[model samples]
Target: MENESPDLQLQGLHYLTGAPVRIAIRQGRIAGVEPLNDPPASLRQLPWIGPGFVDLQINGYAGMDFNTLPIAPHTTSRLSRALWSEGVTSFFPTVITNSEDAILEAVSAIARECEEDEAAGSAVAGIHLEGPFISPEDGARGAHSRAYVRAPDWPLFQRWQEAARGRIKIVTVSPEWPEAEAFIRRCADSGVLVSIGHTAAAPDQIARAVAAGAAMSTHFGNGAHPVLPRHPNYLWEQLAADELWTCLIADGFHLPDSVLKVAMKVKGDKALLVSDAVMFSGMPAGTYESHIGGKVVLTPQGRLQMADQPQLLAGSVKMLPAGVSHLVKRGLCSLGEAWEMASVRPAKRVGLPFSAGLEAGAPADVLLIEWGDAGGDGSEPRIAGVYKNGVSVWP
Candidate 1:
């Protein structure tokens, strides 16, 4: 699969050259990349060339939720194909706050699908267990079920690790939770990525977690109360902590332009964009009942709000590409920088080796886009095409 003839050639697109370049693919890997003026006659002319986006945290898409109980056998594959259409070549199936049995069951089902097929774009690189070891406070916990939220338990984590068949990639927990630091260490020792989130952890706790191998702050600012005093809090503490990588849901509703700019300034290249999108995403704008929380509504403005509280963010209505677009639209970063936040940064977060933008000898996972005015409204970017392993997987 890795050693075969160059089957596809894409020409007239910029490579980080931001100037036109031609790319050739062989088998399932990149064969060559050259200036656009002198390309093979067969290469297809296109407008954009970039690395395919990789989402590190995505719950569900296209009306199919991964956390649905009595796990559906084909749900992962179905969602994977749907995400590929949206330019997500890879992602972690994030399962938030549920009973222990439900978590294990979900992990088992995902592991089965990953074991069955590697090409299934929704391959479970790892399970993002976002809760069960989180803040129990109402506003701090977001929409997670408080009954299931508890202190971190090593035995429980070990059981889940076994159930995932070693596919549990990242675990999100509150640093303030008792035993969280130890759990972070255990997760690090087992080669899993630990992320701090849904917490009121002080700067010292955050530092301790970082030293213990908790490397990320999940959706940094979205889960807190609407109003925060002008002093140190999880938000400001994380921003000041240089060792932490922050993941932001760049959906306009999750954060304001001002806060987004500050976060980008603090994290720089370490900032990653995630959808944190829920089951309601990819569905029509309307009221919907969530499995974890009560009824929620997707507003016409693309905000997902709690039916009881209009000001709160239920979850994100954005996807990975849109998240990147939000960063660029807000003038927080350039398109190339935003693209890296969605692609290379996430690929590195998940420990994938092929983080290079578009280069020869890299994986043939690429995205084609048609650029528009930089100041244009932040609508979802048009995906001209997506290639996975040198094969055209989306149009």
Candidate 2:
């Protein structure tokens, strides 16, 4: 019924209270945004509004693994609908280290779907290829199959680009890999966002990569060997590299609260929140089998293994909204600050032009949330409703 409303009005939304505001939606696009007023009894009692969370890295959810199967044209659309229910109206379906055929097949499928229905696809903006060009070290490589790891080959990248039909938005690779700097330059020249991760790159190599055009660090603190003497590992180097935007899992399990705070401080608005949620994500906490990395045990504390040998994070069970909440709850940042990480920051990192916050003429992609009590130590916040392109897509 809400979707049927050609023109709908929402009042009483605080809009961070920097002056009162009213938002009007028409035909699934933001018709206008103006100062707030108590319109009528009919327009009252809607939840408070904010921008919808945009995740730049999501592997899979709802028992479907993106890397496990060659993504069919309909499969991405189905997953897009599923993501809408989770308050994500925009996401980049990340395909990690896998066979070349699988990568091309999956990318082709997603690109085809987006081409068919760009808006209804819930902002399938682009594809994130995490790797094949990365370190082969067991701990550093994490769950990626080492057999497929290789040096950055420009010709191979060109082939994958053709297969993807130019939908590859970002590529994460190890800076230390041979010819990586050159590849990073080529990627930047071609408008692909290049990120450094799954790496054991030396300080000089890290600097070189940053200079070359690697602008982000994927899941900064995770995917590394368990033991390290102290400062100056890949994590530290990435943090010190001021030019690189850093994305962190922030699901409490990936990085400690203190470490998360440090990362947030180091990167500031350059920090972005990513789910990295796997196929077992929306499933309940229990033992689950991952395709790349074998069996993993999930606990109430979130996923973990012995710290002595940090193998794989598999992926995150937390979604983008929850990850943003985690950042706020841990005192790492304020609610507005957290929201920026999930929405604007990632949009900028990937060079997306439509940074659709509550701006007039922007797409009417919005979220309404009921804030939880601040004093609660472990209480979870809630997403009351979500709208994509001015239409209520989830409740």
For all predicted structures, in order, the TM-scores are: 0.93, 0.90
Model 1, C-alpha of 301: deviation from truth (Å): 3.0
Q: At residue 88, what lDDT does model 2 achieve?
A: 83
Overlapping backbone residue pairs in candidate 1 total 0
TM-score of 1: 0.93
Task: Give the runs in model 1 whose Cα sits over 4 Å from its true position.
Answer: 1-6, 38-45, 373-380
* Candidate 2, 189-219: lDDT as tens digits: 9999999988888888999999999999988
The Cα error of candidate 2 at residue 379, in Å, is 3.8
Instruction: Give the runs in model 2 whose Cα sits over 4 Å from its true position.
Output: 1-6, 18-20, 39-46, 117-122, 229-231, 304-312, 372-378
Candidate 1's displacement at residue 330, Å, is: 2.3
Residue pairs whose backbone atoms clash in candidate 2: none
Candidate 1, position 78, lDDT: 81
Error of 1 at 279 (Å): 1.2
Candidate 1 residue-wise lDDT, 1-395, digit = tens: 23334588886556355666878888778888887786545443345678888888889886778788976768887887788777888789998888999999998888888777665533445678898898898677888888899999999988998998888889898899769889899888988888888887777888888889988889988777666767867778888878788998888877888888889888988998888877777888899987766889998767888899887677887887777777777778888888888888888877875586677788888888765443365455678788877777786
